[model samples]
Target: METVKLYVIVFDSTHSAIAAETMLKEENIANEVIPTPREITASCGLSIRFNIDSLDKVKNILKQGSVSVNGVYKLERRLNEKQVEKLM
Candidate 1:
């Protein structure tokens, strides 16, 4: 099986998550608003998942917007196993 790597931006609230999703969409960035993965102990239930290449753009949009962020995380999945790490 192949490994899948992605990054997730955990927001502080649902509103922030939704707002971030909109901002990313406006920039033509590919993203998905997913339930905050159980592996990440965050305050909110929503997170935006995007590819590594879009990290900088996502960060810039979040910084420019009023969204409250918890942190950024790196997620790696291979077969039935997965790894998670806090990057920010």
Candidate 2:
């Protein structure tokens, strides 16, 4: 098995999250709109998940789109355990 580092972009609202998803798709940035993980709490229920490697590009895109991001987190999952660390 391989371990991967993923980033979660939390938004202040559902509309912002959805809008960010659309903007990212148009920008060719790969991401998924997933339920906010239990380890993290935010104002919204949805979050954008992407690889840690794309953090810089994702930030740039969100900035350009004027998206309101509540927070950015790094998530690690191993076997039955998961850990979340706030990055921004």
lDDT of 2 at 20: 93
Model 2: per-residue Cα lDDT over 1-88, one tens digit each: 5666678999999999999999989988889999988788765889999877788988888777888999889988887778888877
Show model 1 residue runs off by greater than 4 Å. none
Q: Report the Cα RMSD per candidate.
A: 1.4, 1.7
Candidate that scores best on TM-score? 1
lDDT (Cα, 0-100) at 56 in candidate 2: 90
Instruction: Estimate every model's Cα lDDT from 0 to 1.
Output: 0.88, 0.86
Model 1 TM-score is 0.88
Stretches of candidate 2 off by over 4 Å are: 1-4
State the weakest 10-residue window (summed lDDT) of model 2: 1-10
TM-scores for all candidates: the values are 0.88, 0.85
**Worst window of 10 by summed lDDT in candidate 1:** 34-43
lDDT of 1 at 20: 85
